[model samples]
Target: MTGAPTPVSPQQIPAAYQQALRLQNAGQLQQAAQIYAAILRTRPLAEPCFQLGLISARTGRRAEAATWFRRALEIKPRQIEIWTALIDVLDGPERAKAMAEAQRLGLIPSDKSAAAMRKALAELETGDPRKADRLYRKALEAGGDPVPLRETWARALFDRTETDAALKVLAEGLAKAPADPRLLLTRASLLETAGRIDEAEADLLAVLDARPYHPLAWLALMRARKQPPGAPHVATLEQRLPEAAADPEATRYMSFALAKALEDQKRDAEVFAHLDRANTMTRRKFPWNFEADHGFLRDAIAAWTPRTRGQSGAAPIFVTGLPRSGTTLVETILAAHPQVAAGGEAAVMTPLLHPAVEAWFSKGTDYDAQAIGQAYVAGMARKLGAASRDCRTTDKSISTYATMGYALDTLPDARFVVLERDRRDVGLSIYKNLFRDGTHRYSNDLTDIARQIRLFDAAVAAWRKRIPDAIHIVDYEALTADPEPHVRALLDFCGLPWDPACLTPERTERQVHTLSSVQVRQPINRGSVGAWKRFEGALQPLIAALDATRYDFG
Candidate 1:
């Protein structure tokens, strides 16, 4: 074997190199490179060199990559693949150069269709959607079976808020690929956005019937159920919850749907149970609360929060708590006020803290409190996107503020209206509703749901002890019973002028997408206050831990 490591043939290595090329095409770059490297150790090949250049171009290694492409072009002067790979790695000026070279070498046509697609993809990547749209259209005009081009065009249109055009594109695509689940889901979402809830629901159901485990179908179905006025559909949703309990995605929508249904029935405990389940499952899947991993979050808030501090302008109002709690209702009420823009579940603050969290993981250091605060404000501004300038103040009702220690620290000048519903009600509501995301950790089991509630309650109590002055605890029972007094007090806390509409959140036309979507559409009813008492027989375990005497609401 020693001397025979002699002259390894290119034929002997082509199999491995070809396999590497396949891997590269399939988006498995690193593995392909390793195989290519192995082959190069035995023999040099033009195909592997060209493929390596393509991989390098994709991964942003442009300079070193040009050398590989040149070497491949030299070895196979007439190869179209080498010329294409070289052009792919080039920037604007370099692309022009490569194209000129290809033309001179007679390798590819100057205005070939592949060239247009490459240019279009590059434009799309650089954020020029309008130009990219035109290029994609051009690619279709020059082409073969323009369905893929239509799909991309539709997505771009949707991104640019041309919903009607987007719908038309996908609707036509659906005519061709009627059974495609993704197309069906997209078409349904567009329909829902266009306020055709009935049509959306039909398409969504068609998708689910074909692919039973489709999570988006379940969520769209839940949304559709909310739009309609009926108990039968809600009952159907309730039955489907257990069927979808095991899948985390399914459980979210199930918990959300169940909570909405139970709330409509004025079953407070059941509503709370389903809502809490949705929250638990969501948190378990993706731990959004930055404070859970850092005690400094609690510490930062206590230190940074000034006793006599006030916001300069109308400050951002945070309506937050457990998922099934009255966070959405509180926001609906608050948003009815002329001064506030209700920015639903602003997902900004968490992402701002992520890099710091990751740094802590890497460097074994503590999170910078001042940096976090600045980042939070900036993050909120970013999520506000277009609406940041529209209103004097905005409201972000992210419901996951049960772990608000860090978020409170970040927005020291902001006002918080913390909604506190009964623990049993929270748990029951969470268990039944299908939340749209994986944040419902308690969706499957009763025991875990209750434990998560206890955790949230403890966290909130700790926040009260730490920063009591910063938070206004709005009891769900009190809010539902006499909404005006609480609503007025909340308005006062936010430093806003009151409107009577705050007491009647139902009349607001702000697209309420929460468990209280239906309830918030009605007059504040007293029936929901202690309605969980009816289910006391079924919720014994939840009641045992959630001492009714402590709340003193009887």
Candidate 2:
């Protein structure tokens, strides 16, 4: 051996990597591999090793790819994309080992775009949206293809109530990548939220032209159009269901779309059948643990007592309840008032409360009430931008009902408006709606939905007892039947002066970002009040569960 091999300097790495990437992008795989190998000889860097692994796997050398991936991981253990690639090529004990390693490293299985998106989502779910926003921006800045990044980034922005910014991002993405189906689909949804139904419909139709059999596009088209009873598309939807059977997600989308069409046509049996299939698949894909959820609720209630006082502020009004239980209606009504801005489903509270609640449950540590309060204020300010500091706002995040105690303890002056609906109506509506988010896992199972309803009732009752003056109960039926008085009462409780505009919530120009987006645009009516009775036969499980729990619908 000639003394020792020459080593590459750190200064040369970036240029070399760029060259490798150029070669790879140009389809010169052999040249890229040679460069990668040369880089490896001088320095055992993870990027080169990862590239070598990708080339090997693509070229049918699975064993060699696995070896390179292993080397890459050894050099840089937190490479999620590498871990995912290795797992794909591995098998038997080796695959098990790689999986375990990935778990230990907290590496989710995904490619570049998917990994970034997943991490961002996980951050949002855990209540660190600021971190999630940073990650999303970082991904966008390091861009080659911008379509997927833009779509996800816009969603994150939208989730934080950055509605105008989200739309601008999507518009920019569309300008760069014209007619991209995903971008079109997402933009259409945003448009729908903004009450631009015609524009939303146009975008959806364009997506369908590009991807005719796209299940999500078809579903969005149905919703945007809001086809009347016995529309011709009912048959088309029925026929396409079989074509979509091979893909579970596609099948779920088609099923829900078809059920909506059938419901419009008065085919209750077919509607129920399709709903059942869709819900069943959704439940299987994302199982819900009733006991765990109940335990968390109990812990939350137990951790915060009546004596706990929160840091006071000009508290934002919270409109919360089960999905489809008039939260949107209440928010729309309130937002119509000049002093109130509707912060549609801002997920600021629960995430801010998570760490404190966990500490209480695990180590018996008392919640940092003031810290939680400050965090919520800061988080909402970020989400709402200028709007956060504006006049009173309402956060219509329905799940906040579960964390009411934490919320009360954090923002002592905060007002909560808990919405109640006919139990059966709530159950049926939840089952029918194709919720875009993943949090409502209990919606797909009747017994689970009923149990959740009972839990919600119990939690609300407990809160009522603990802080009767702070919480206001609004029944959906009562609100719709006599909207004026109920709305006046709501305004009074929140300490707002009466205004005539609050009575015409449907005419409010603000965006309604929920399943009830379309419905909230129309005047309040009793049409949906007891509509669940029409499908009583198909909702026996829900009825029985409600009966067992002694919830009086009458």
Candidate 3:
């Protein structure tokens, strides 16, 4: 029998490779690329190869990017991102083959039906909404797993502003998979989104009835409806918490759910106890390394500095900040303008920037930042189709904050609106919401959340100092207090003519897919401001962490 392979130590990693990473982060792509190439000559590693792939892809060399990604995957077969990158470059049977390999390696959903649904979802990610719609329909007709397929399809339809059609799709899925907890939970979420609280509660309850200890179902139920005096679920959740101890994931969910239920009962101490327990368990599962995140910010700040101008033209607006901040609100407001279309968090910037950054850092080569910027615009234009050509578009991906330095460097004329909220409130909101994606794992723990917020604060502060002219900071509270003037200023900053529709963002006919969807559908209000005050006592650790940073909440 073969023994386990020896793990590579930090000492074993070439210093040049480490330098390349630092250079890449700093936006010195050419210098970083040179270092990477030299290291590859001595040792062909997956990481450097992946870096090369990113550079290739960013330079509009899709075919070369696919080749580099394939080479990286040959070395590290389990790299899911490499597979995704490969699929992004290839089409037709080649893309299908790569996806099948991903499925076979268990990089994606393993079940055949779920795998097919994942492929359909991936098409949506590639900016092909029509193709995605067709694939979803084909999957449904071919008897793909009723639950995941239906849930994903419904979400896609909802995102496209076909709310009634999405509801019909969910209803049909529920009819097929009557007792499926996932389907039930999805329907409940949709109902909640629609403000049909009682119906949402009923659906959540149905999920719990079928699977008594379903964590998500229980959490959904708790959020869907307020508990009456002496709520019966308190005792049930308390009992299940101990039973769920064996499964950390279940314990995490049950503890948070019970905490909310206990809060409703005004059991402050007990509420905190449950929250602490849940956060601890969840944090253990996904630990955060603050030093590494901070280092990236430091490098980014050092790398992106004022340089000679590049070609300029109409550029897309980037609405970015920490998650749970007012990014969605700003995006929605901008999108409401007749001259603006919502791109809905299209991840076009990072992929384009990564490769260019790597190449720039490698050898200080003069990369065409204009070409990169125009390529991103072209990609978004294709995704948005001909209709968006007449107007500007907004990419509201919160994580795009990390790529802002590179973004401004490449697209010199691009406008950025950075949203700010109370750090304490932001932390609390992140904890309370059950994020649909795995990107925000840090939100599961207060300490990690605080650390993350600090990282964002540092990056924003640096950007403000370095590129103040391009970035506009919008405070959530200030905007909520009086939106018109702020909206007008924001529009003017983006060079858009004043439009009354920007003031009535709620009436805008666009599908919002973020947690703030429901909140943004209404006029600005102070309801969410200072929301952390209720749990102030329980959030001592988070408060202390933020205090250490001495960041201005305003």
* lDDT on C-alpha atoms for all candidate structures: 0.63, 0.79, 0.75
The window of 10 residues in a row where model 3 has the poorest summed lDDT is: 1-10
Better of 1 and 2 by TM-score: 2
Displacement of the residue 228 alpha carbon in candidate 1, Å: 11
Candidate order (lDDT): 2, 3, 1
lDDT of 2 by residue, 392-502 (tens): 878998878877767887888899999999999999999997887477889999888888899888888877877789899898999888888898898999999999998
- Residue 156's C-alpha lDDT in candidate 2? 68
TM-scores, one per candidate: 0.57, 0.75, 0.69
RMSD of 1: 13.6
lDDT of 3 by residue, 1-554 (tens): 03333333333444565566668767787777776666566566787789878877877889988988988988878767889888998999999988878866545544555656777777875657677777777766554245556777887666555678788988887776688677778877877766566887888888878878788888777765556657887788788777654334566788878877776766766777777777665665466666656655665556665554444775789999988888888898998888999987787777777666655655465567778778888778755665477888899877767657678877788889999999999998888666653457788777778888988887788677767788998989999999988888899899999999888888886766677766777887887798788889878879998887633212
Q: Model 2 Cα displacement at 95 (Å)?
A: 13
Worst 10 residues of 1 by lDDT: 545-554
